[model samples]
Target chain A: MGIKRDISHTVWSVRGNAVMDVVTRSLEPLIAALRAAGYTVVGPTVKDRAIRLTEISSAAELPDGTGDVQEPGNYRLTERDDGMVFGYAASPDSAKRFTQPPRQTLIRSRGQVIEEVEPEAPRIALLGLRACDLAAIAVQDRVFLGGRHPDPAYRRRREALFLIAVNCAVPGGTCFCVSMGTGPKATAGFDLALTELAAPHRFLIETGSERGARIVAAIPHQAATGDDVAAADEVSRTAAGRMGRTVDTEGVQEWLPAAHDHPRWDDVASRCLACTNCTMACPTCFCSTVEDVTDLSGDVAERSERWDSCFTLDFSEVGGSPVRGSQRGRYRQWLTHKFATWYDQFGTSGCVGCGRCITWCPTGIDVTEELSAIRYGTEGPSCIR
Target chain B: MDARQTGRRPRLAVWKFASCDGCQLTLLDCEDELLSIAAEMEIAYFLEASSAPGPGPYDLSLVEGSITTPEDAERIRHVRRVSRRLVTIGACATAGGIQALRDFADVREFTSVVYARPEYIATLERSTPISANVPVDFELRGCPIDKRQLLEVITAFLADRRPVVPGHSVCVECKARGNVCVLVAHGTPCLGPVTQAGCGALCPAYNRGCYGCFGPAETTNSGALNAKLRALGMSDPDLVRVYRTFNATEEPFRRASEEAEGDA
Candidate 1:
């Protein structure tokens, strides 16, 4: 699924699809329906004092009446006045956790016998996925499935996924989905798109697939009026205005590669720990490395594919020495790959402006600000020399 | 016939100097896999397991702890000569352990205060790592080297390959495990950004900040992380104290701690 030109609810209404209005209480039934169809329903839930994507058996497990306060290197859960499901911004994790796992054994061998390990693709209905993450899933799809040699494990998991995208109402302090043109409203790539409205406490659902319609049909939902559509549009419009950050993407694809020697990289490198946090938290970054391990007897061996980051010195290792030895080169490679080189490789920018990288960074390094520094040549206050 | 086909197991020796013996205990803690490891190789000289000492010309020597005494310095050199490959295990052997904190201050004063007879104690002024005394083939990092990683090192030795220990930060392991950033989420002072990837990011996973047990990563910007920690209300003393734990004598942590002390 791709980002649609028009995000207005009227466009979806005009497409002859039923705009169904379901109450906050109907979420339990929606979850039940997904589970009844042989799916392990997963959604955002409060865990470790943060909203983490995990398997949720009931809708009550969702972080209702809860929001989040986020800044560079900071994130705190706050209690909201109204009990609204999907009240917070993007979770610390994204759809990638389900689509592309952190670790998967690809091959296993026992002495003379060798076997390729097939991935266990359980039908997972991902609920409360924001548009930024939906877009990230699309980027991953291009990375894993679009190319000539498609990753079989990624393919199996991707095919089994049932996406349920949520239109973000409460934008996090680090969110810049508006600037990226990827969020505030779930435009596409969802089986069912939901916009949670307050005061009346209802969800305006727009079914994107036949499977979504089938599930919604089973649940008790009313045919939404024009008022509901307008209300849903207003929620998205307000969220768009309240975006915590913005990136000027104009001509970024052309100039970022040429700015390799720019002093901003050295500036970022001084602050960048090369901790691999930004890449790990990033929704769209799909780099991985293979690991081979054998038992003590050397009889049983396994080759597994695990998530890797460009920040690691070993990631750029060639002939026993890393080409990007300095933190400056590593950080530059990551930033350039995300914003500029990604377009060349995958035909789209890597960043969805979800702000996970900003929030999760130990030093609070803002990617948007970094790009602005590169583009405008305005060096921000240096924290360290 | 090859060594494996001829049923000639390689001799493996375990050694200790000045440490808590926790790293040695990690080898013993491998309850299930210890038997398999024993079956694969000859457990020639592990005092922790058996009293019977084996002959020299050992295949591999897994040394634990630091060289606090002059005798240990001489012993490590002898160990290097006898063993085909000498792999130093844990923070003590690799980075001088927490005992290396004496490197910053006077050891004589401490001996006088603690010991009844300071004259009886014959110790070096500075507790140095095994690498400082002799040529080490590999240094397995951690406050107490992880059993899994220790096994991996042994496996690599048997396979005639280099051990696949990643030199990335604890943040990589923490993020891979899908744990929330304790430092970022709660403003907890963590060494995860600079600490080496090992122990599966134990502290952060349990909602506590990293203590740099595995020492600094291959490439670390502690100055940057220190700035962030300072912003989170960490004082100069706190920075010094935090960096001066477990693998305190490691270059990056040692330098950072010294800088913090200087700033203080």
Candidate 2:
């Protein structure tokens, strides 16, 4: 017996020589197939001077040979010699935007006629999703769908989606998914995981779901060999090794609460703009509040929920008094919750270590640096294994 | 006036001014207390809570943020009209917030540094507290007001009584918590002596000096703190930065900061 079959799906790998041709050739066919199946094909494309997820009809629309340089409040485009279409790291916009839009209408009412609006189920095939984003989706699933009060709208949108995950070959300046134990390779929660090996123009496809297996079987592909598996493993390792940042999460939950009053918060808060760009770019930040508006005529009324951040002074308002009255307190609350309290609440770190917050912030406030300050300030016993 | 016998719950309204919508979020953080509060009070105008906002002659109004623009100034007055007992929450509403850093410098310089088109920005030269513009019934201090205190205030309002909020210094809380004083022990420049009590003296417990997010305590001796800060080798600029925190505009702190900078 060579290898036991795990399921109905076949594990296939393409020769390095045939990788690019297979990818280019399959791109249009996959889009056409998805479109014909009444699904919108959404993938990475150059938009607003950066590679962002957009609707794609063909491979020509893909962000070919473009990589993104991300820093706090600064992002620029860089060209790559390799014609890899999905060569870049994650963009400022996460898949959460599509799943949980910035503002969503909850209910509408007009006099006695109160109508509850259910969001229309949109069938979307997300192409070239990075591993960090996949983990972010999992974090969101825990927040919106797995919570005690499941959001009916988010559940509907999530149920009607197909995920195509891509193994990141080049990590961005801000990426630290390896430290978060969430990325560099697509391990699960995907319909299909594609590793692009362009020499022979083929994508090494691994099916994660039943639907993915069906899609793989429909496509023209070859069975995996020992050499192909080794190459795939090597590429994943390289991607993991490329991460520029690492967060020491060892006993962070236990340490942060103990070091709550550390002077480090004062140092960090002084520089923080508190503009809330970090929370906006953060994929796991689920804090939101509802807003109601009546038309000028007062006949038609609508309620909408929009994203809110803890950094804002009004976020903690109560009978004419704010609890966290200083930028220091607010900044401390956000960081501690993400690194420490989140583990107490969710059994995991709130941050996925995407580094988007670090890069997109106007002031370049790094969470890792702040955490380091706490680690050094205290005299507690070390927990790093 | 039994609430149930009256057949009309006290109307509650939430208002926002010129700040990020963070302090308002603290109310929503009271997830367990919220539904119960809703059961007791009729939420008339919480834009962040419900879409159907009833016209307000609210018994209680929770106001957040500061007056930073001309529009905010007018809007706050309108809020005061609708609210019978208007309470200003957070540092911004009470002490002009971190945005009040604009008060120390030329607004044009700050705007040029932050925005590409400074002309497009419609901001007052200085951020001012809601009390400066309207008759505030109460002022709650904090960068983000504590959720528990918020609940207490709401419960007190429902009962037609004054809210139980401590006005002592952070030093009192630090002593109550039995934490070693970071300032005395480590020679750290702590503001716990002059800052308002709240946050349960969190910074001192973490082995850091308090940065005075809760603003001024009643009869705060900032002059004494400034002398101590100078003794601890802090520069005049550093002292200015310290006084100009969450409640920099408050009288004692403002006067002390001016004296420290030799402007008095």
Interface Cα RMSD, each model: 0.7, 17.7
Tens digits of per-residue lDDT for model 1, A334-365: 99999999989989899998999999888889
Alpha carbon lDDT of residue B90, candidate 2? 91
lDDT of 2 at B155: 68
Best by lDDT: 1
DockQ of each: 0.85, 0.03
lDDT of 1 by residue, B116-150 (tens): 99999999999899989989899999988999899
Q: Write the per-residue lDDT of candidate 2 for residues B135-229, one digit (tens) a residue.
A: 99888888788886787677666655566575656654564353444553345778876777768888878878888888887535465456556
True-contact fraction per candidate equals 0.87, 0.00
User: Which regions of candidate 2 deviate over 4 angstroms?
Assistant: A1-25, A377-385, B1-264
For model 1, the superposed segments whose C-alpha errors exceed 4 Å read A1-15, A18-25, A379-385, B1-6
Model 1: CAPRI class = high
Candidate 2 C-alpha lDDT tens digits along A1-385 = 0122322122233234332212323566667766776779898887646676778898789888998776433456789888877788877667777677766788899876889988866888899888888888887877776647877788778767778888888887777888899989887777778887766655677776556556665666667666666676788899898886777888888899888789888877666645455777788887776656553233566777766567655567788777887878888999999889987777778888788788755446777767876887545432111
